[model samples]
Target: MAFLPTTREEMLQQGYEQVDFVYVSGDAYVDHPSFGCAIITRVLQAYGYSCAILAQPDWHNDDEFTQFGEPRLGFLVSAGNIDSMVNHYSVNKRRRDKDYYSDEGVMGKRPDRPTIVYTQILKRLYPHKPVMIGGIEASLRRLSHYDYWDDKVRRSILMDSQADLLMYGMGENTIVEVADALASGLEAKDICYIRGTVWKTKSIEYVSDYIMLPSYEEVCKDKRTYAKSFHIQHENIDAIAAKVLVEPYDGWYVVQNQPPLPLTQEEMDFTYSLPYERTYHPKYKYIPAIEEVQFSIVSNRGCFGSCAFCAITHHQGRVISTRSKESIVEEAKRITEMPNFKGYIHDVGGPTANFSREACDKQREFGACKSRECLFPKPCNNLIVDHSRYLDILRAVRELPRVKKVFIRSGIRYDYLMYDKNDEFFDELVQHHISGQLKVAPEHISAEVLDKMGKPRKELYLKFVEKFKQKNEQFHKDQYIVPYLMSSHPGCDLNGAIELACYLKKIHHTPKQVQDFYPTPGTPATCMYYTGLDPKTMKPVYVARTHEEKAMQRALMQFTYPQNYDLVYKALKTAGRMDLVGNGPKCLIPYQKPGHFPSRRDQGKRYGQKPYAKKGNERKGMKKR
Candidate 1:
């Protein structure tokens, strides 16, 4: 009904002498289900526990740590919704100008690696109290893994933060189990049997039947050993099929239990139905984080589409956990009642919007296959391709009173949509869901790059595009696909970048923004980025690590931009791809005169548009902007 206590006065106002947990967050408090901090605190409260929020406390002052006094149980720490290093810096390791999660989109509201920093501060102030770290930052770094910002292998966060326990993955189940244990007077060190947690131990006498990973020293000294360790971690991400994994570190051992089971439909519904303020704390001037999610609904959790660049598979697991259609409709009703409601629902999807059900029947009972993926390389033969339920959910929300439209704003798995024999979902998606454009991620057109990225082949994307155009025509609507593209990913060289540029030139669409591969922890692609070897196959992979090469790769994705012409030209020349630099229709750019640069006029000429002609929002095939 109200936001959790954020100060001692608020804590007293709630009539709590001592709270059960003090939730420390790197982000300004936004009590929405979209944020991990809000969900954890709200879940604890729903389970008859009192909790307080310590949002972005100044790390320098000891008074900030003692503001709420001490919790009855312990402290729960998270580095906001994203990793702090990632939130603070771009892929080029440049400091970002803004932090959307902070008030007024300010920067420097929190320190780098705040999960470790905050927990360390908490430990220094309250050394005896347990400090548990979670969120994307802690979850991905729960073991000995590569730290891109540090450019070296770092120990588990539990070891660095000196936190008694670390929770990985979606922590609804894990948090509650740990809370009960703590309230019952069990020490943090004694509570290790719970799933979805990483704990440190000095002896293996109590640990049994666990996979022993290469020692931390070995992985640090050898990239090949690190790749091998990453492969072991990747295979054990499944909940039902994974075994406990132990990594030795000198005199101590870090043990990671198998991931928690995916939430069932009922549990997911209950979690979302918690009493949430659904906005940032009232005292802040403005919180930029609310704009995207205030009117949206999270219809599901978890992703089965295991893209190599994505950390969702490792953090949320490969199992799909979706809410019931009724639950989604209820949330849609809530959105319509908000004062700022514009009769338009911004989103009604999660990790992969169209992944509204389990990939196969055996997954829920037996977990996903350890060695294979559901839709990469090829769709599993046992994969179930149906979207009727998701379509039905969309229809119900669309037909609700005061709701003019409902959009699936999240990433849609085009390959999954194309695989469905029934076109009902696809038809309705084009006709009803799209707000003039639908965003899909093809990532790249190069076969080797796509294979390395664990994405389906370009043929699948081309087919999906053809079908999308047909559906738009059939429905008599103008809709375009906004393909999300990435550059400088491992296994991508100058030739591969040129190949993608040619494909974009052939399609007559240039993305306004292109993501340079960010080597964040826990992703298979990051493993390749750090080790220059594929963990899955142990094959050597090409990595563009230099600033100039990364810039060229990114420029190739936006090759038509006047600003990127020099970089694109350099990339073409470097790749010995001068054949694509001529004044031909297929050439990405015209041959340059010494000191002469192409303008928007030349770009239009290449697209066969008249100079100074107005390029309106034309939904022909897939115009990305």
Candidate 2:
């Protein structure tokens, strides 16, 4: 299949006078299933709607926004695959030097908060046209969210963008429904009842079976109220059990309907089977982001491992959805046929590689337990920990012609793998899938921090490490395990940092880089960071808020660096850990020489010199002595 029309010429060539929908994106046009824009547009095309691409329009002026003209149906806007703020800035709020999604890896292709900016431009250019926003930037910010960059509780994107509608989460079903409704002569405001969407209204009288959340004013003023509102939003994410949620702001209400139902196997297959060019437009020399996923196949979606820092549960839901084996193999065969086909397939996994099925049987019928987690502290007894189907799919793909090796780069939940009674999949994974080092995220070593982060205890990770080593030894392979660690998370202090350092020292592993816990929007960790309390329990939690304190904690994780010597020394001293300030093997840093320089304790005792002596006077006094 040919690439979609990205310009008016192409649109005319496709035998269309006016397109049905013009999809505006923050990232450069890449027709890959991994991209949300591609999937949503293709789904619409499958339903016989003409869609044109407006990838990374120049946001400074209204001219670029009118390139595609007004579409017959509406405008679908997305802030690329990632949030614009995250793409443009680093966790430290520094402007990023490069953007992988842009052509030739250039930065500033799209403005910060592209969804709002683009929609505002569209509304200005064509006042009567309906504008809708989706993708990660809009999905996670669909409701009142804590904006880390702004350092304030901000209203929903719907309020800021003034778009008629906002579709959150995987928007295939929702977008199609929206298009069909609009194509059938329904105004955007009149089509507000679709699931997996957020729409604004002047009143809540029309909303039924809905829960009224704390208003935007309440959430902004009170952290406890925000937590309560977030909790309600969290609980109502499931399609089977969720109810409409209404949040009021300045006499207007933003209503979030229940999430769409999880896609069945056939539905997943159909979506993946859509004709994707599987590469970026030829206009650009290359897109760095496509390199990471061109050879990768996403066999599944959603994650059951609900880590506190992760937003998968909020966006993808907890239920696992898988594509058919035939569909996966066909895609692999197609990959082998590509001109740049190498003997290797980069990855065959999704959010959590091993999660091929729902966490338990009851999850499909009643939705995931709101208060409890599927894999945290310990695996639920009702969890159906199996990977046979996944193993079969991998084996089939590996046997295909021209396929040399298949790797699982997407993270595998080590805790879930450890819970399975059968070790067949584990053995195969170690034997064939691993690429030199298997990376697992054991975020912290302190049990207190782990519990607060909703991660398993340190012992579980250790056991997994032991098992991984044994398996490598059994297979006679010299493979290693790389544990991803984090610092300065809630419930972690100077002592916890010291504890993690000690653990790393015990293992004789010095990580080159440490991840400072970034408190992004719509995650439990972010909530804790902003409120200093766990939303799950509403109990007070310790948070490292100061820059110096956070820096010290991060430096301790990599204490071997020469530049970190002073920070480590100060941190140890401040924590009254003078025992760790010597030249001993266990000491993090060496003590400074006594009387080596002017100090508080050695001010007047240095060679019996006067305290106020100038440099020349000190030298003369030394000569006289």
Overall lDDT per candidate, in order of appearance: 0.91, 0.89
Q: Model 2, 516: alpha-carbon shift in Å?
A: 1.3
Single out the weakest 10-residue window by summed lDDT for candidate 1: 616-625
Per-residue error for 141 in candidate 2, Å, reads 0.6
**Candidate number achieving the greatest lDDT relative to the actual structure:** 1
lDDT of 1 by residue, 481-559 (tens): 9899999989999989988988998889999888999999999999999999999999999999899999999998888
Q: Candidate 1, residue 309: CA error in Å?
A: 0.8
TM-score of each: 0.95, 0.95
User: TM-score of predicted model 1?
Assistant: 0.95
Across residues 471-532, which tens digit of lDDT does each residue of candidate 2 receive? 99999999998889999999999999999988887788889778999887778889989988
> Which residue pairs show backbone clashes in model 2?
none
Global lDDT for candidate 1? 0.91
The local lDDT score (0 to 100) that residue 205 gets in candidate 1 is 95
* Number of clashing residue pairs, candidate 1: 0
Residue-pair clashes per candidate: 0, 0
